[model samples]
Target chain A: MIENFKKRFQKDGIWVLFLLPALLIYLVFMAAPLLDSMRLSLYTGKGYTPTEFVGLQNYIDLFTNPVWRERFLGALKNTVIFFAIHMIVQNSLGLFFANLLSQDFKGRNFFRTIIFAPATLSVLVTGFLWTLILNPHWGAINQTLKAIGLDSWAKPWLGDENLALVTISLASVWQWVGMPTVLFLAGLLGISDEILEAARVDGASSWHIFWKIKFPLLKPVVGVVAILTFVDNFNAFDVIYAMAGAKGEPGYSTDLLATFFYRTGIAGEHPIGIPNMGMGAAIATITFVILMTGVLIWLYSSRKNEDLV
Target chain B: MSRTQKLFTYSALSIWAFVAIFPIWTLIVNSFKPQKEIFSNPFGLPQNFTLEGYKAVWLKGNFGTYFLNTIYVTVISLALIIFFGSLAAYALAKWNSKSSTALYVFFIAGLMIPIRLGTIDLVRLMQFLNLQDTIWSLIPVYVAMGMPISIFILTAFVKNLPREMFDAAKVDGASEWRIYLQIVVPLLRPAIATVAIFNMMKIWNDFWFPLVFIRAEESRTVALGVSLLFGQYRTDWTRALSTLSLAAIPILILYILLSREFIKGLTAGAVKG
Candidate 1:
């Protein structure tokens, strides 16, 4: 029995050492805190430490309480819009660029490099850069419009409540379009050349080929791209914080779930100027649930069909 | 193939290319001009060049220290993630067991979820460990955050590796560690490069974690520092542009130098192959 146990230990020991470091760090640093934050959401705290367990009270306030409810719903709505624009504009442009690049082309590498350049820069930098370019009175866009004698076209880009979210979302789309471009390009390249050639031999145009054949094959990648956009925009913060400020300024037209959480939980929310840790955790939990639901759906759907990705 | 198709592709691509390059061009060229000139000539090349913005950024801020801090965190976190991540991935690829399969699924789940959700408890965790407000705090968090994707990519790469290589090494009486180092490590260089570049972009350019975890001048990262300076220098366009250019230029230069590898690396996570 002792010898058998030793043999089993010998077989296990090396793998255990290999796995433990990453696993322990992942659990203690990332996974545990994520789970604990959910638990902490149930209890209100005047400080860092929660004094009382108010089970589900924080969530209730988040849903029903006037102030929290408005911010939560506003952020949720804006995130959806932000994600929609990314899906429609960024991914579409990405597919467009990918289609163009996948064809026999000159300077394809150069264009691909230029297209993806913005994504490498910090979102804070891009956010601030766009804030400068989109400045109302003296920005590049306005100045160009004025110079071109289309002065009427230039308006408050970031200042308007109606247009601010779209403007920021476009800026974000501009920055990250390269990602989906690269992804789609890979998917496009993966299409067996013979199949596309056969379609062309049958007199199919590029448009029909792209929509009818290429797109259906690219579904798995699209799902990946969609879930990526969802996770990113749902928690989108740095862009808004940098462009619009942490309060999601211009009357909070640009507040995202992440920035909203920052204001409420980490920094004190405005006016009352006190950190509500529990409420912030509640927001985080909600965001987590939304993300998990989106992910599970994608997973279930993808599992049903053999993915090209 | 047709004239019209080629023309449409070139023109459309050229136009989109311009849209892509224009803002960044404005950013870089504007930084070199003086304050008044920035507003006057936002579109033109710097007619009269000035290093005033760069000088002010250097003198007025801990920009140098923040730059170094970012590098330190990125390198340390990357080293940990690669070392530990590769080890686990190697075992997962080689070991045929139900537990390994289960563990692999567990790590891969992190790819879909954002790590920011844990900031509430993470803040407390940092404070509890006396790591809050220190650059030391960022490393562990980043390594942990990097794990899932690193494991996801590396394990796939490793699993695709030839079985004969591992068997041959073992047949020659090599230990698992020996096989990993001598055989696996060399073969994994490309995948390692992919994982490194991916995580480097995240760690180097991240603003959120630095904002939450580190506040001291000594501890601030390039992203956090730039954001702070942007807030302070809102009205001073020249300085703001220069500060941004400073933070952005290194990675931009890196991207330019290694565009092919960089593009491939960034897409590694999404593209299964």
Candidate 2:
């Protein structure tokens, strides 16, 4: 066994040289910190230092303690609502657009470029731009509504508590719908011309063909898109932070786990904000677990589906 | 398709396209308008195109410095990600051992787990390394964050290369390193471009790491700079819009020029994986 191992090492050892730099960097920066953060979550701390191991007390507080629980549950509900909006509004529009663009329309590339343009821009730019457009005073939406004789329709979209979360979700959907559209378009294109042609030869209408043939084939892509959206929405922060500030203002209506984690762990409370690194780490660990579990379940189920197929 | 269906498609596409471009249009138009004009006619074209907003942001806000800093960070990080990622991908693709499979899985796992969750300890780690608040601090983290997808994409590309070439090189007495440097590196150009473009977008537009890791003014990237400017100039609509336009316009122009490559790189990984 030793001789066999030595022979294998001698043959493949050069590969280690190639892998070492990235491995070292990823292990140190990405992997190590993840473990350390999980460890930190088990301890209690006042500032940046974790002094005592109160194993899982932080997690307990995250669920039971009123303040932390309120914020956590609120952020979790908002996050789910955020994901639901994407799954419904953003993805449906993406599919509709993908279906439209899939037709051999003139200037398809032009339209594709225009639609996907926002996805490439910085989230900060998108958030800032939308904040101006949605601003209650002298903002374009309100002014346009007034101009068109719907004077009472426009409100402070980002400033109203009830409307804030939905408004931010809509703005984010506006920026990112193109991603799923492009992905679905790719999936649409993957259907062979022969199959489409055969379906056309039949009396099946385009709608029937899409529903009966194309949509079924696109299930895998749909699953992938759903999982991607789930992970991304759960991890979302930049757009909300850019628009509503870190507090997820308008009464924390737009607070996400990401922003809440930022507030608790990194930034702490404003003006005499003592950093609750332990609690923050707890939040981060919870987020990590939820995300991993979601992805693993999707992976396992998708693999099972493939086997059954 | 029927005439009505065609018309519907056209109208829907047109409306959505308009919606997509409207915010950006507002930014550009309002950035040039005087403040009072923007307030009065939010949707109208600027009465007169003015460079004052741009000038103020460029000179007073020091966006020029932030722009250069962003470019520096983005380029350096992309270089490191592509170099190390391609090397590691090449090894994993060619070695074809049990350990290679394990390593591939390990790296790809980074994709599902958002690295930002580890921000708490990452900050502590950076402080321990004495690298906090420096521009150089971002490079390693970005490289590490970007490696998983880079390695994943490049490995697929490497595996597609003809095997006889490597076998022939081995027979010619060329060392593995020389072969990789001379033969494999050159052949991986398309994959490198794909990886570079993807990483460039992420590292260029990333705000989270730069926000947490760097607080010093000298190290602020464009995203952080623009966000900070927006906060400071909340009521200065013209200047705020101008700063956003400055941050956005270059990327929009690049996207237009390279939309095909950008879309291809983005969709390629999704379709395959």
Candidate 3:
């Protein structure tokens, strides 16, 4: 057995040379920091370095401390709303667009390219552009509304407290709808031509076939798209930072958990203007937990779905 | 399909097409107009065109430096990711061992758990290494962030390769490196393209790392530059729009030229998973 092991090692030892660079880099930069950040969360201090170890205190403060609690809860609420908008609006629009593109049609490639062009641009650029376009006075949307004699419909998109989060979410949806569209389109196109032909031969209407057949077939892609959307939205930062400022301005209505983490951990909350590294790490740890929960749930449900199939 | 169904499809698509294009059109077109003209005629096709915005951004701002900095970082990071990623993936594919399998799972886990959560610690690491304010800071983080997806895609591709080729090369006394160069790489071109395009988009468009690590104008990326420009030129609509347009036009042109590959590359994960 020892000889056999030695032989295997002698033969495949080149694998070590192949694996070391990536493994070393991954361990040092990614895996180490991720775990160490959790360790750092137990400590609290000012500026970039947290020297004091106060176990569970930062987490407690995040939950119960008045100043921290309001911002924490507000960011949490807005993040969920941001996530919900993507799940409903973004994914629905993606599915609709994908279904439309699935059928044979004219200018199909042109429409596909047009729909996806925005996704190539930076989120920062899109956020800033939309903020300009959605401006209350001379921006395109409001001006066009006024031009069409719907003057009363013109309102501040990024300026109002209640509207800011939703507006930003929609702008993000606009940028990324291509992801799900392409994913869903791939799935739709994978449906066998024979099955679609059979449906047509059975005298089923196009609407009936799309709903009863194509939509059901798209369940797996839907799962993947929703999970991707959930993960992306929770981690979203650039949009709010660009459009509403890093503070998630307008009374912090647009504040998502990521921007909250940025404010608390990296940039430091204003006035005192010192980063609370421990609290930041704690926020990250919580975001980590949330992401893991979501992914595990998705995995379990998808596996169960496969078993049923 | 019926005539009404065709009309419905075309019109519905047209409305969304309009929604998608209008903002981008205004962004590009209005960048050419004078400052006040932008606000005065927000949606029009620049009746009085000028290169003033572009000139200001290019000549005065550090826009050119930022563009070059972004290109340098993106190219170097992508090269490292592909090099390290492909090597690791090839071994994991060929080395039938419990440890190899475990390592594959370890890397793949990163796909779900974002590398952003590790930012605070990474910042500390960067400072410790004296890289906090330089372009070098972003390289390791992006390469590390990119590893999981690259390995995930490339490993799956490698696994399906004909096993007999490796055995044949082995019998012929070809060293593993030679075999990898002469054999695996030739076939891995398309998959490499897939991996390259996938990570290219993320690294090029990324704002978070540059935001966290770099502060100096010489080291700032395009995304960072745009954010700073927005703040500086907030009241100057033409310059602001021009900055955005300058940063965006290259990507738009690239997407149009390589739409098929871009679409395939961006959505490669869906197919792979």
lDDT of 2 by residue, A1-309 (tens): 999999977888899999999999999999999888999999987887987999999999989999789999999899889989999999999998998998887889999998899999999889988888888977889888988999889899999999999999999999999999999999998889899889989878988998999999998999889888988999999999988999999899999999999999999888868788988999999999999899999999889989988
Candidate 3 lDDT over B155-222, as tens digits, reads 99999999999999999999988988899989899889999999999999999999999999799999
Q: Identify the candidate with maximal DockQ.
A: 1
- Runs in model 3 with CA error above 4 Å? A1-6
Q: Residue-wise lDDT of candidate 1 within A67-111, one digit each (tens)? A: 779988999888888889998999999999999999987888888
Global lDDT of each candidate: 0.90, 0.90, 0.92
The per-candidate TM-score of the B chain, in the order shown, comes to 0.98, 0.97, 0.97
lDDT string for model 1 (B150-206, tens) is 999999999999899998888999999998899998999999999999999999988
Candidate 2 clashes between residue pairs 3 or more apart in a chain or in different chains: none
Q: Could you give the CAPRI-style class of model 3? A: high
Tell me how many clashing residue pairs each candidate has: 0, 0, 0
Instruction: Show where candidate 1 strays beyond 4 Å.
Output: A1-4, A271-273, A307-309
| i-RMSD values for every candidate model | 0.8, 0.9, 0.9
Kindly list the per-residue Cα lDDT of model 3 for residues A79-125, writing each as its tens digit. 99999999999999999999999889888999999988899899999
